[model samples]
Target: MFRTWMRFFTPGAVHHRLGLVCLGVGLQHGAVPAVGPRVLDGYVAVVISSGRGWYRTPDGRRTAVTAPALVWLTPGVPHHYGPDPDTGWDEGFVTFTGPDTATYTELGYIEPERPVVPLADASGPRDVIARIARAARQGNPLLEVETGAAVHELLVALRRARADLAPDGDPVLHALARDACTGMTVADHAARHGMTPAELRAAVRRVAGCSPKDYLIGIRLGRAQELLATTELSVAAVARRVGYDDPAYFSRLFTRRVGAAPVRFRAQQSRAVPDDWNEGLQEDAEPGPPVAEPVDGP
Candidate 1:
């Protein structure tokens, strides 16, 4: 029998205000039977630590596997994949759910309606698999936090493995874009980073093909869409938190950028799109912009 839980690290449990499924890992062995394709309930990722097999999907498809590879299965996508009966496979797998996981779908990480990404190298996934298995078996309170961190690490490794797969976009530019979208002006961010606005704009354009301000707006709009979908905040409240003071202006900007009013955007998002993100929803109640706390309280 395949073990769903294994013993490893003892990270404490995590509490998510918004919904996020638990993180867990397992290893299993099975011979692929000629059965109907299995559709994933959510996001399922498999790292073939060692195996030889072939997987197929409808529309006449096949993935020949030997050595280590990753397979990602997104929710509701139908596909048939399993080990060859001749050489039954050994596999390590994990499952997780949250807004970020949903975002991966948008980014095409779990697409092709094909939910698997076979890693070219096994070492990274192997180590992470061990850690997660141990943590699950131990059942530590901090498992959520630890498991989340481990998932992030695994994603980073996967990004490295698939770096050539993404467009040439600077990570710094992406950070700046996010900062700008959250209401930081290009001039303000440039000043903070010891660069003039023109210099910052030039750098951003070179990599992201957009001016700093435009990129920022894109980032902010994306965040607003997330909030509108997941929270009960009024349009004005969402605007204010995202750095817009006038709710009317925010609605106009949302319509111009996102092609819909805030209310409509929220409706569309909830109806079909599932957002697992919960980050910016709490900002409205956070008193003010985040600041470093005093090292030692008076």
Candidate 2:
């Protein structure tokens, strides 16, 4: 028989504060049933590793579902889908909901308009599902929080696995980041890249979920923060390093966005750095081991 297992959760009110809660997770293969032609209260991401089927959109149009694809079922949106019972394809899915789902939607991570997405590879996201499945153990004390955290990882994995992200996602974003610390206006950057200001804005918005000016400014501030935390650079020097020649203006912006002035932020980070401080995982790295929980032994 093809494998099938699942667990549903009712995370407490406190778990919702994690910004995203894992409502449930499952894996099924062969003889799977069709879902919906109905609306959902939360969200579900159906990852098809090996299968062929069809899905209905909000407007009642039908779309093909092939292997290595994702079907996003959003809240209140009518969706219907299932695998071909004759072939019985492998499927994995997770349901999630939280206040941050809106923000994630805004950031283009949750594309409601494009519910069916092609994935470059299914292994990464499936690995996350495996982790979540392990955390679904009965009576596990940290099950809620552990599964909740895995939801964040799953989203990131799915984003990275997008078929369109290959050969480097976007040249424009890389170019913008490269010149982020340069003192160039949005118009100037656009002109240099042979794009009109409006085109630049649209491109950045589509890729980064923000305007070009805001995108560049974000990168600049991020660098400034890193320098402040890891180096003894003065505020003026840090400002210059991050393309802000005006130290006073930089301080104001930093305070407004970060809730602390540069000097104060630096002071707060004055705690000594650990020897292996930079050993943290890279953006696309696999998840580290889960927090240790004692296993019952007979």
Candidate 3:
């Protein structure tokens, strides 16, 4: 008599805008019986983390579902599935739908024709389903968006599992990318990851198709852009926040790469004007050395 836990969500305008929304998530284990041979209104992805089961499709086709496998319960499709009553099984599921789901179906990402997908590695989908369940329980203001993003990640994991794609990139380089805002030099970061600078650079280039310095700089610039657009932080503060100790140096680099001074960039973003801010500027425009500020910039 194992208890089942389930949560349902009502999506809002934001969820609709994202073109995807999670409707519900649930978990069940031990002595679970068969469920209806009826049609459902929304898409459901059921993953069996343990034990075994059987799934029947609308066309009376049957398939044995083993551990670490997934069964897609497509919208408006008649299906029946359940765990072995004697052995039972641990199950986790997320129900979701969106306008983009049709596109995904058409692209063969979500194959209603092939409902049972054997997963070589089920951990990713399991984790995502747990995340969706947790978000549903917490009922946060951004639950829809958060769960929607998780659903997208879940789909990606499923596709990777189906394609047998191993995780790409070095773990050390991935950690460095995540901690790029720490302001450490490339050599220091490499030492921390127990790799030489050259090794780190090669690994980054192999996986990210960029040098370590360029990858780190991209991460920092992305964060800086977010801070500039969303917050009222001063230029120096934003620079420091993204690991740049010198605001002047940061401004010069940003101008060279992003084609705008930080202050002018912030002003343009705040105003939301569509003027040709870079009009008359040479295609190969290169700024002088790092300066605190530039006149007529952006």
Q: Best TM-score goes to which candidate?
A: 2
Candidate 2 C-alpha error for residue 237, in Å: 2.6
What number of clashing residue pairs does each candidate have, in the order they appear? 22, 0, 0
The lDDT for every candidate, in the order shown, is: 0.63, 0.83, 0.77
Error of 3 at 18 (Å): 0.8
Tens-digit lDDT track of model 3 for 1-298: 6559999888887667797888888999887879888889999988888888899877788899988888999988889999888888899899999998987775456878888888777788899988887788574877888899988888877766653334563577678778787756787777787878887777665445567788788888887886786666678777876777688889998899889998888887754323364233212234223222211111
Give the worst 10-residue stretch by lDDT in candidate 1. Answer: 289-298
List the RMSD of every prediction in angstroms: 14.7, 11.8, 12.1
Please provide the root mean square deviation of candidate 3 (C-alpha atoms, Å). Answer: 12.1
Q: Which stretches of candidate 1 lie over 4 Å from their true place?
A: 1-20, 29-36, 112-118, 163-298
Residue pairs in clash, model 2: none
Q: Tens-digit lDDT track for model 2 on 71-180? A: 99998788888887787678999999999999989987899888899998999999999999999988999988999999999988888888877636788889889988
Candidate 2's TM-score reads 0.84
Which of 1 and 2 is the better model by lDDT?
2
Order the numbered candidates by lDDT, best leading.
Answer: 2, 3, 1
What does candidate 1's lDDT look like per residue over 91-203, in tens digits? 87777666677555444444445444555567776688677777674447767776766775665555444423333546667567556435466677777678777777766
